[model samples]
Target: MQPHFAVPNLAVPTFAPASDAGLPLHIVTERTLEAWLSQQDAATAGWARTMGFSGAWGQVVVLPGPDGTASGALVGAGSPKSRQRQRFLLAAAAAKLPEGTYALASDLPADLSPEVECFGWLMAQYAFDRYAKNTGAKARLIAPEGVDAARVEVMAAGETFTRTLINTPAEDMGPEQLQQAVESLAEVHGATVTTVVGEDLLAQDFPLIHTVGRASDRAPRLIDMRWGSEGPTLTLVGKGVCFDTGGLNLKPGASMALMKKDMGGSANVLGLAHMIMATGLRLQLRVLIPAVENAVSGPAFRPGDILTSRKGLTVEINNTDAEGRLVLADALALAQEDTPDLLISMATLTGAARVAVGADIAPFFTDREGDAVTLASNAQDAADPVWRLPFHAPYEAMIEPGIADLDNAPSGGLAGAITAALFLRRFAGEARYMHFDVFGWCPSSLPARPKGGVGQGTRALFQALPDMLALS
Candidate 1:
């Protein structure tokens, strides 16, 4: 069950009026902070000091009105730089503080984006209780007035759901369970759903998908769910390897700890789908997830194996561990068949991406310049960061093979992430394709985000889609 609200409605927080209102809020920036407190009655200063007014995390200082009653709260976020570095610091602090309405005594730091603050607050309210033997403490924050509470809830809860799904162990997140997860969303949003599984994949011509999945007992499948109509078709494809043991090209024990999040791309796609449908955006939506487990058994597909893809391209399995591209090949082929107006795919497909951009930033590749610009702009506005990496045609040779149509992996170590995108691009055809090689697992707990599976690029994509569709 969802946890109880941390901040109850009876005591929701408010912001100061227009005289103090603006984005990149210096909620407690030094300049206005001292002056604002000085203007308040002596009781305000005393209460603020009592609550630890220096702006440290977990410091719960208060402000009192002229009558000596609590006016609001002034939770300190240590340094202005600290506020920018960690989005959730203030929210987490407010969640555990005594219940009451609290206003931002000053604007947020200039470096802190509005969306960062908004999303951060939502993060503080998160609680994963699905497996909890006993309910834990509820954490809630009052939504600032003028914000769409439901929209905020959707983005926040959707992100949490994505992370939760990816963070769960593989035992609880197999292909079947992945399908069920999508089905649950379909039921809620009235989206149409379909699945192509097992032997039917062969009949339907998803040969690469069949080849790689043949070893797993749970059955490999492609999940397709659709929402919206009467506008540009926006197809979101996700690589859903529920768990990757790296096939016969086995990963070391150390490498396998986070394999449960191998499908982070798929989980994140579903999360973005949730936000889109919740907002009732004016665009047709199609979600495709090629769910499989890259396991090893006598029947597992091996290196040098050649398999035909759903799009009729032959691929040589240079490394069985490179299974994400194989499954994405089939799903992307399917997505391409419709020639959707916009085609985007997300996957935790390459470790090179993490090495290249680190965990916090998602490195994305897109075929269109306009799309890249729009996405980057939206990412800035949404405070969800992504960097555009070229689809670099010259690197296409990395996956070129002498025997089969293409190699599942490149022989050269350089440009691993770009080559992977080029590999998936082979299946994308001429559709305006964009791909995100996301690091699904967060390495450690940060202020707003916990250390676990993360849905890296969904919010930026969600924020951009509306405008992308408008132009389309």
Candidate 2:
């Protein structure tokens, strides 16, 4: 079944007109708000003091009306510097405030740009209502002055698309479904798409991809999409393991529980693509997704199997569970063959990445010093946090297993993420490459970010792309 490609309409909290808003919402910081609070009605000031509502970050308190109805709300935003560093700080108000439209009553901090406030409001309103219903109405906020409403809407749409793709179960989001989604996106943006599927992958020299996916009933494929023709080339490769049952080396029940999210890298890549196309960023963009399901069957590739990659390197499958890298290897080699100006590969490739950086922060590996510095700075500026881990040349030996040109999984298991990256780098060749080891699942809920499939590193990369490529 071809998956529907219509961009899902996110329930962005409505932005009411100032005249129609219900009550004043004062977002005050710790160091700059005592005098402002004292100037408020005496009764409201007493109510705040009685409730111990000092302006600490994330604190929300409602003021009482003359008839004891909600008069307004006071939210604690931390220092200007701190508030500027985080995204969606006002989400606490959106999630907790009484269901009514609120307007910003006081002057916002200089650091809190209109874009930040508007984007935060939109993000705070996201909820995954695919399986169940979200019947509760969310509080509305008036769009802050000087904000670009259209830009905010586009960003929200892109993020919603990503989260929806990741949160859907594997049964509904396998290889075929992934292709449909890509086709849908391409159709919307007037981009061209091509796919090499099933036995044809072998014919095309993508042996590792076919070998990993051949066992599944749903035929595996490579989704290639391109947009624009007049700018520097930017190629993105994502691991699209729709459902990783770990092939012949099956995962435990606990490990397989969330395997549905293994395709998060592709989902995020598509999300970033949406942002670029929607905003009309000038670049020649290409996206390659090696979509597959690593299932166990009589034909499933097994351990110790030798598979030739598209780059002509032989890989020794030390562990069938290490299938993400194998599929990515072929796609990466294909991407490098073009020698694009910039190439990025994203994957839910290793658990050690999660152990090292936790779920919220993504870690990236890159050999380009200037690109690394640019990405880190843009991540901070865009409020999408990322950390850099070394490519570590010495660990390259860990990927060589003596028998084959590379080992999918190395022994000792130290720096698993690094070893996996090294395995991919062999195929990336000399292209300016960056690999993101991302945890696409958000295990716990935060203010605007719910507990479900999330996009990691995408926003950071999106924000940095133009500058990194010198297209800005």
Which lDDT tens digits does candidate 2 get at residues 136-177?
226777776776666666666677778888988888899998
Judge candidate 1 at residue 427 and give its lDDT.
93
TM-score of each: 0.88, 0.93
lDDT of each: 0.76, 0.84
Tell me the tens digit of each residue's lDDT in model 1 across 49-109.
Answer: 5655665644555445567755556655556665555555566554554544344435555
**The CA-based lDDT of model 1 is what?**
0.76
Top candidate, metric TM-score:
2
**Candidate 2 lDDT (Cα, 0 to 1):** 0.84
Our tally of clashes for model 1 stands at 15
Highest lDDT against the true fold, candidate: 2
